[model samples]
Target chain A: MTNISRRDLLKSSAVTAAGATAGLTGIASASNHGKHNHSKSKRVVIVGGGIGGATAAQYLKKMDSDIDVTLIEANKNYHTCFMSNEVIGGVRPMDSIEFNYDKLAEKGIKVVFGSVINIDPDKQRVITKDNKVFSYDRAIVSPGIDFKYDEIEGYSKEVSETSIPHAWKAGPQTAMLLKQLQEMKDGGTFVIVTPPNPFRCPPGPYERASLVAAYFKKHKPNSKVVILDPKEKFSKFGLFMDGWKRHYGYGTDKSIITWIGKEAGGTVSKVDVATKTVTAEAGEFKADVLNIIPPQKAGPIAFETDLVGDLDWCSVDHKTFESTIHKNIHVIGDASIASPMPKSGYSANSQAKVCAAAIASSLNGVPMPDPSWVNTCYSIIAPKDGVSVAMVYAYKDGKIIKVKGSGGLTGPYNAEDRKREELYAHSWFNNITADIFG
Target chain B: MKQTKLILIGSALLASSTFINLAHATVIDRATILANTCAGCHGPNGISNGPLTPSIAGLPKNYISESMYDFATGKRPSTVMQRIAKGYTDADIKALSDYFSKLPKKATEPKKTNNHHGHNH
Candidate 1:
């Protein structure tokens, strides 16, 4: 059938029946539908309920409550990856970082707790694992990163689950890693293997090392935290180094943290799980608690469908974040290739707003508004020491460009300033969570 | 392709005249777009739940723009805002101020609920 004829058929049936209309709006609402209120509402289906999807869902309703928004998520409870490091550090409890969709449901968005198996762009339908299908005029995919376990020899998803916990995702793995940390004997070594570039939360591994060192300082003063990094430098590198020097006594024999960069042979070659040892160019290092954060790619759903044809991540137009490969499907968050924008929760939240605005504007048959984006990643190094990197982005030429003379790292170290940044970090947590899940 | 063409035309229109100067740009939606990016830390509509940040909602346009200018120019000693304010143009600041100045004065009190669930251990 021709595209126009199929839409006409859906519209004719939609006008006759009011009950079976919400799911049929994507097909029926293209042309005028004879003054029927149900047919006038455009349906937008959003997959994945993390920062990006949830924010898009909330903001879409906020912009036009008349548009139908449905959010499909695999897990009922969401533990934000942004602050999961704090949970692992034993500073904040796991429950504080965890949230449910009750608030979003209270708002007008339809919240479905199930895994989506397929998104048929041709048919404009998202099918869940349970065989239920949802149709939409536009679809937003915010599937966060998935690990490339095979990139690291002797490492797999099963290995990450049972033994060396990545704790990258915030749920059970976080708890598991925390348990391992607590159980390790005093003076034992805790090793962390970090991933290469283009991973979710670029500054995360360093922040993880810092907080873990802090935890050791209080609990096991003699214990050491070793970081094997694949990159020469990391996000907020100077600030992290400064914090390490002040708090952890870094660069001394008594230092609690040791970072081995790729230039110093920090790249991992294999992991001997039986011996709890990691082999790198530096040599095999045995550990009491090992963490292997493998290289990453777009979430499996992006690969399962045709969203990412030849690339590891989806290519999107910065203006609207619509997938260049597939029409009407917008990919945001870590799954999309939005360079100059780090894969932080703040970036996802920022991108979500732009995507929501674009989708809303398109559905209303109006010219899409120009977009502006902002992202600030705050890392708490110690209990009261924090640092950050921030940027404001604009759509220029054909890309999102960081505004010149704006955005920078935490300036030259002052104890009072670092403490204040810590407070701001906490405040940011409260505000962003409220913005997304509140 | 159709959407891309429209966006190009929109850019062309924006490039040709007073529209390039965002401070005087009359399209009201531009202000909202600039302001929405602030919702991450400032709370939605600039109504902050504060102990660290202030509620900028419903403030006078002059006060808001002046504060941003101060932050941008280092006249205001700030933790993060100093760096953030530098990113915006004078026109962007004007648009943000104009946007925030119109919001309601209502602010939700910072919630102090102890929502700690059980430890998995």
Candidate 2:
């Protein structure tokens, strides 16, 4: 009840005034040390060291080196989901996509490898699983997406781990799925179950299907890849259909890749793990390798922090990314609902920078600068063939709107252009990882 | 570094000279924020690591603005730049050109000793 009034106050105040209040709070806390004490460096604690959290940490330091930043992540290393599809398709090693916080630490960000148990908005502190309490003037949570395992019958987290692989989080699950695909019979089917909309990486399922088909075509010519979708269409639909038709005999009797949209009874209701069968409205599919990507919501940490109140995702201010539900707490990455901007790693990284700038300015009692964001998601369809969709965004009329005529899909598939996009996609991975963890 | 010293001297000169760029100072800061988004693929300071994504750091101011103008106007052939370029205003392009052209082209690649995961398309 009090938080509603606080949110109203924040909404009514000028941008700098909200930050000025935070600045005053910093001074008030620091002056508690002694009567003659000087103001301490403002402390920012970030939970979840994914693309958004990592980028915010690094950029906050860059904006003002005097600010003390501490980043807490559960895992010592991060396995990026962006290019993990390449690993699943056997185009690159898993180690290539794996990154650590060593570079972020080198930038003077305190990288703590521990699970965050709680973020107390009232106390302005973050509590870890081991009872470690970190006080902060501001906090950012970038907890990525979590799956609703119960959405499908006979499928849960345990089943996803051991039997059917989601491989959405891009770690051992990826390796497991890859091993199954490799060991599969040459004429067998690799079934991929697609999730609904508002999920991380909108085009991810199609990309996975493309790469797997490529793998099957090379090593097991008689094998096929089947995608059962819950939606009528997907990201870059035309581009993907073209690529599939050109390379995988899609729409032909000998097609290696078959896409069943919702209209075609692609909505799956159950999976028989014991028999490796997927039951969709279209029909039942028996497969040698099954990849089930279940529906998703914000990660557990977001829910644990009470950031998402009766919603699947966190609500944030378009300009500052500060939570609309809570004060002084910002959420970015896949956990926050940023429509018009797909939940891609590039969008997370871009949002992180804007969020960081807002936090930095707010802490210093300065007006938040105007914000701009851009996202370019590149997906490799097959070797030497990649496609991309890009957009530039601006904050207008209290909402994030895409700049008209600014972004588009990769033009008509020229081999040279496709080849170049593939290269850029790899380079993008290199540069973005470097920007975040490096 | 020499760059910092030059920047300091430049600021001192700007303070003494006509306040022509005073109005542009905030615009420059906004442009810097806009430009930071490019580092995801272009690398920090616009010095790219990948062969295809060219380094735009330290290029001539005129050249940078001209190229961006071309990209925005569809005169230049680019895979993603045209879409990206059309997003910025002419003022943003000018400010970005001025900001990036002044920085050194070189940036330290993140320390990676063992993992060399560069794969060809």
Candidate 2: tens digits of C-alpha lDDT, residues B1-121: 1111111124454344321111110111587688888899888767776756767788899988988888777677777787788988888889889888987866665333221332112
Question: Every prediction's TM-score for the first chain?
Answer: 0.93, 0.91
Q: What does the lDDT read for residue A402 in candidate 1?
A: 95
Deviation (Å) of B43 in candidate 2: 0.7
Give fnat (model 2): 0.47
Candidate 1 runs further than 4 Å off: A1-41, B1-28, B107-121
The best candidate by TM-score is 1
Write model 2 residue lDDT over A1-438, tens digit each, in one string.
123333233333433332452322221211112123222336899999999999999898787665679999999988999999999899999899999999889879999989998899998889999988887778999999999988889899999889899999988889899999989989999999999988999989899999999998999999999999999989999999999999999999999999999999999999898998989999999988999999999999889988999999999999989998889899999999888888999999999999988887766555576889989999989999989999999999888999987998989989877987888898888888888887
What's the DockQ for every one of the candidates? Answer: 0.20, 0.26
- Against the reference, the lDDT scores of all candidates come to 0.82, 0.82
Off by over 4 Å in 2: A1-41, B1-28, B107-121
lDDT of 2: 0.82
Give each model a TM-score.
Answer: 0.88, 0.87
Which pairs of residues collide in candidate 2? none
